[model samples]
Target: MITLATSVFGIVLCKGEIIKTSVHGPTGKISYKDEGFGGMPVVFVHSFGGNVSHWDGIKDSLVQNRRVVRIELRGHGDSEFPKDGDYRISSMAKDLATVVNLLGLQRFVLVGHSMGGSVALQYAGENPSRVAGLVLVDSNGDPKKNPEEIRTQIKNVLFSDAYVETTETYWKQLLERSKPEVQERLFEELVRAPKDMVIKITSELLDYDPTLSLKRYVGPKLAIVTPENDDKFSLHRLQLGFPHKVIQNAGHWLQLDQPEAFREILETFLQRY
Candidate 1:
């Protein structure tokens, strides 16, 4: 059963540990669920406007044999909003590093979906020794996409006074194959995320080039994207550089759209280590 912790600022669920930490001199707290099982830990990072809940579909299956960690990035879930308004991907990467150091994690696999994938890559680049492998799920690492145009479009919508309507429409299209309950919860979290923070990080993300980060990661890497996501980020292009796979007949949210297939692919990748 889901438990919630409501505050004047917003609602935060009580599913995990509320880790009070700081990154880049800005103090804040992040909510993280650590399935403290043995074996190598697999850290899972969620997409834009997503919390740890995004991994619910595959969490149990993943945690069965190994340790699994899911974190709710600041401004996105139960985590506290940054008072300094620094929500850069690099900041988020530092937050991950803090968590790793706090838990004393030595070597593990890092998996990230969408924007989280970029954060994972950043973390791996910054701290290459801690990460054993990398799994990027429908991430925003493609250097081909025009950032300026994307940033303008995103800013136009996000900065507008009336963005809920646009967000609702976008959410509808995004969560096509998600279950009704999943759709409701995810939509709420996405909308509940701090608008300014989201806008800032995403805007910075547009200018942030992930090629350097990807190139720096020398360990085993896997890139997974859905057929629907192929247009925005090319699977063929990624495959040319690293091991890339596509989840057939799935959308951007492949974990929710095709959980079984997603798990199978993860299982295959995990076997490599």
Candidate 2:
């Protein structure tokens, strides 16, 4: 049992916190966090260049209403990296499926950000019934068709060498709104990603074409378009042929950039499901 004593910031954190323990994946352990109880479980997946803590800003709020979980994908945060070439979205989807099955959860919501959202989409596409709903935040549908320079600019953010040396404090500093120490601990445990996987994953992200993957996921999906530092929305609109909601004043990392707005938008969307 996990327990957390909290009344700070008017947030009620229950005892037995059930923090992210390791979930065995195909390659290795996939790290994740969990909290709250008595309602449907929801998993929040962070983006590239981000660990699951990115959702902490809004997690406590969500936990008030439902059991909320976040996962650190392979090669990021505390998760183990794949020694082989199994970082593709399909493989990642399988890893997530294993986690869900292990938890014995049924009828839960899947919330994913950026690349993590890509993995969620593919999974829901194939197993729509298993997913109660989906929340795709600042996600990219296709990058290969993007303007070469635009993709290049975002690439800088993804594979920044700064990501390796930068501690959790660095991420918090960069994010400016995150907890100083908790955020740092997550970064400290991240896999020492190899250069090859970085390049390969970049190719996978940019060229994998999540639009094709979306066609397979038939669940209720919400496309959250971040208005800043994100180009995936337009690409998604054009490629996936769906209408999306725009979050004003939000950047690439919308949850971090506009926590309250993100929380409001998320709750509003989830209410319908």
Candidate 3:
């Protein structure tokens, strides 16, 4: 049976009786959805400018067997924005820590997509013992990979008066091959996000160094990426030998683009390590 309800606190019960709840983190209220029960819990973090719904396609299948917790970073979705405007990745990871601690998730797998993957990396690296496994989906772990020139170019456009227009264009390019409905949903969410917050987070993401975090978390790790990002110097290629797989013909959002293949790889990883 499935029922949906929203409480005064803004919590919602979605399909499959998933409990959508909120927790007060260091910055503000962080919203998350808790569903299923059993096995090591898998916590999902969405990409920048994205919300909990980004995991809609994959969560249903996993929730049938293991607990699935999808988190909305501060300033995204139903989560309250930080009044102080601290949008750094470290602060974002702290928000994630607050949610997991509230749920009493002692040990579980951490799955992050895009910028969310970076947050998962930061959290897992800091709390190595708490994370049983780490999965980064199309996430970049090395800041150096993003050259200064490229960063400057991106920042110029993001900080310029044409920020919103540029952002929309950028998103459109990424979602070019995606289905019309998928593109529309994501674009709407992106448009609704605060422009300043988006710019700040993107700036922080560009400067984030995942080297120490990657080294700290020695647990089993898997890097699922698309063909365009299967570079020899990528974190998966360099650190997670033989545990990386590139989903063919998929874009940045491979989970949505090639869910079956992505799920198979993830399930295989969970079964093996």
Query: Which candidate should be chosen as best, given TM-score against the real structure?
Result: 3
lDDT of 3 by residue, 152-186 (tens): 88988897888988988888887777667778777
TM-score to true structure, per model: 0.82, 0.75, 0.89
Candidate number achieving the greatest lDDT relative to the actual structure: 3
Residues 1-273, model 1: lDDT tens digits: 344343311223345633222222234776677774766789999998887777888878877778888877767666777778888889888778777776788999999998888899899988888899999998775544765676688768877876777767777777775667667767777777666776787677667778777667788888898766656355225434777788876556788878898989998888866
Q: Model 1: runs farther than 4 Å from truth?
A: 1-26, 147-150, 177-181, 231-240
Question: How well does model 2 score by local distance difference test?
Answer: 0.70
Ranking of candidates on lDDT, top first: 3, 1, 2
Residue pairs in candidate 1 whose N, alpha carbon or C atoms collide under 3 angstroms = none
lDDT of each: 0.75, 0.70, 0.84
Question: How displaced is residue 140 in candidate 3, in Å?
Answer: 2.2
Candidate 3: how many backbone clashes?
A: 0
Give residue 14's error in model 2 in angstroms: 9.6
Error of 2 at 110 (Å): 1.1
